[model samples]
Target: MSWMPPDLPSAARARLEAARVLVVGLGGLGAHVALLLARSGVGHLVLADADRVEAANLSRQPYFPEHVGRLKAVALGELLQRIRPQMGVTLVPQFVAPDALPRLAAGCTAVVEAVDDAATKAALVEAAVAAGFRVVSASGIGGVGAGLAVRRLGRLVVVGDECTPCAGATPPLAPRVTAAAALQADVVVGWIVGNDSGTED
Candidate 1:
């Protein structure tokens, strides 16, 4: 696809095309991460989310007005398939528990944690690490800041400001949320490529 940069090394592109990533949560962060990964030619995506799209989600999420009331996993799976019909996508239309994360992530090349709940995020991170799956997670995108910071926690990489929590008074805006999601996507892509080339540190 033209979206895949011509300058990208064939090996990297091949790796991306062969990658199977698990994205937990189809909210603001996961939605964008899924779209970006599909466009970037990631071969397979496993999407999990139990929530249905609501009007409030239209503001910050990658869903259309018609998607309101539709299951996020189903909607996102359809969107990804539309974007890349050749891409393989699995939709788990249910909330994935932290304890179940390891089993879900075991078959994936990497995992992306984008759930709004901090406890769930932590649990998933722990589970992914224990399962030996490289994982990327988001921290704070609920505030006004558009800036993103990346932090490494063991085998997991975290993206977003370390300070702002979604529970804060500041409401989440598209710019900040999307920025964090983009960072998460980039990190996931990098991890896939690095692992494929045996260059991951």
Candidate 2:
């Protein structure tokens, strides 16, 4: 518990602990974002990711060497619980299909979109907006030093360069990925704490 940050005081902590958040995609972005929200005291987390961990994923992801070949959602759900014993975590070992979006997002305080695919990111933002929940998403997050920025579009907050394609020459590195994830997590926490900044980063 000493490793955890100072508490948010009883009142604000209660508000945060009562919130439920759905984090899509357990890759470089989602994995770190989920952990951050948990550490920030978000009570219930719905983690969705169908992919299994591969050796290559360990480079930037939060997985251990032994975690390779394990289902990402399952592995992370277990770890997040160890970080916050009283937290409620639901693991969806399957991909977040369009039909399942509403059910998964219904009561969530916010949806954090951390998927690599551009189309999937767009779909998540759309669904979260339609369901009347704010979304924190990313774009052009592959390279380092492109610089990170926050852009608001209605109920959506996007972080990243806004132009560096993940499929571009530069592959995803940890510094930028975790930095962006931190920014995303901060936005989610800000919304829950009722001090969300609407300005650019």
Candidate 3:
């Protein structure tokens, strides 16, 4: 019944188990973040996304072929439940409105922003921070061969390069996108374990 890895301190594992996270997208980055958090023993996750799985998402996101045409939130929720059947997962099948973010984030220890739109990301970050929840926002994982980086500004932690945009020009291959998502997940874990100095390079 113990979920902690042997190397993980009991205190850290307890912290992770008590944490609730809200993931505000189910794309490549959000999918990875949610999956990692579940595997890492986060007790609860609220997944919000309006889009359905598409064939194109299979290349970079975590959806299986069978998930295509299903709601991303529902698909990811099912996958997370399969991974950790005891974990609490709430699926919101519609896009989260910016004004509702504070209410959604009220009890969450952190908010992970994996939406593609810059404006939406900004609004989410602002709302999460204002609500006193740690926020991790992703950007620039659309291209190939770019390394990952984590930077913190105030209560907001930004993961991935600031230069890469997911325009039609460069496809978001799985490697780079997953790498960014891993970084986002790691940052959240760090915060949960009280090891984040808020200035990771």
Q: Each candidate's lDDT (Cα)?
A: 0.86, 0.86, 0.88
**List of clashing residue pairs for candidate 1:** none
Query: Which ranges in model 1 have alpha carbons more than 4 Å from their true place?
Result: 1-3, 165-168, 195-201
Give candidate 1's total backbone clashes: 0
| lDDT per residue as tens, model 3, 1-201 | 656798998899889999999999999999999999999999999999999999988989988999999999999999998999999999998989888998877788889999998898888888888878889998776677767678888888988778755457677788888888888999888888898834644
TM-score of 1: 0.91
What does the lDDT come to for candidate 2? 0.86
Candidate rank order under lDDT: 3, 2, 1
- Give the count of colliding residue pairs in each prediction: 0, 1, 0
> How close is every model to the real structure, measured as TM-score?
0.91, 0.92, 0.93
- List residue ranges in candidate 3 displaced over 4 A: 165-169, 197-201
Candidate 3's TM-score: 0.93
**Which candidate would rank higher by lDDT, 2 or 3?**
3
Backbone clash pairs in model 3 (N, Cα, C under 3 Å; residues 3+ apart or in different chains), count: 0
Each model's Cα RMSD:
3.0, 2.1, 1.8
**Distance (Å) between predicted and true CA of 69, model 2?**
0.5
Worst 10 residues of 2 by lDDT: 1-10
Judging by TM-score, tell me the better candidate of 1 and 3.
3
lDDT of 3: 0.88
